[model samples]
Target: MSQADACLRLNGVTNKNITISNNVLYCGSQLSIKATNDLTGASVYNNAVNGSISATGIQSCGTFAISNNVFINATANNFYPAAGSPLINNGANPFYQALYDYNGMSRSLATPTVGAYEYSTTNNSGCATTDNFKCGSSTASVPQYSLIS
Candidate 1:
């Protein structure tokens, strides 16, 4: 059966105080969880999954805080993506881009929008200096601030 890329997935299922950043999840045998059951104060950052994350992306959770995430299970060669694999490092609080939300303070931009939009090193004089507002086929270099000053 070829419809199991996300048979029962849950990423950063949230319980507040959450922050799942720089997203890119491409599961082909999915069963990815990042907080099941009784989730408390949650926080998942720098999230990235290539494929096959059968279990433990923070299931049966607790006070989670998984950081700098980049779990690639490329058919389970194992770089850690199973067995209570909330993707580990669950102590949250380590997602620096100057603590994001720039323009209201806390700045550190320049192509850093992986999971909550943090890409701005100032360059949007109305975008089109070769259109760095990014949107399709690229020679790269077209994304200059939309929300991260």
Candidate 2:
């Protein structure tokens, strides 16, 4: 997949809450926003992708959380670079924070960063500030898995 393509795309038109969880999105070349407004709330977790991914536009506006996600550029072409790719810590806007790092560590940024994995500032094994694994206040466990191999 190229950086010009978006495997999963979401655009909000109203000031409402949006939640996305336990989904598998592959080859996404563009941006992915969990929620787009103050009344919005998005959760992304346990999903796997084979290309660059990003989440933005969720700062003080509402709740935008990305957790337990695995994104890799398995393509042989390596169409995008690490720095220029959308997988960077903060590609579009710096409003989205990283609740968990790539190493499964608990962390958060001073400002919201980009990508699915957030660098953990504290410990690797702890509760994430955004809580991407769980959707909203519900305790019901919803598990999903996507295999690319």
What lDDT does the true structure give each of the candidates?
0.37, 0.36
Q: Which candidate wins on lDDT?
A: 1
TM-score of each candidate structure, all chains considered together: 0.23, 0.28
lDDT of 2 by residue, 105-143 (tens): 443444223444442332223222233332234443323
What is every candidate's alpha-carbon RMSD to the true fold?
15.3, 12.5
Clashing residue pairs in all predictions, respectively, total 10, 14
Error of 1 at 54 (Å): 11
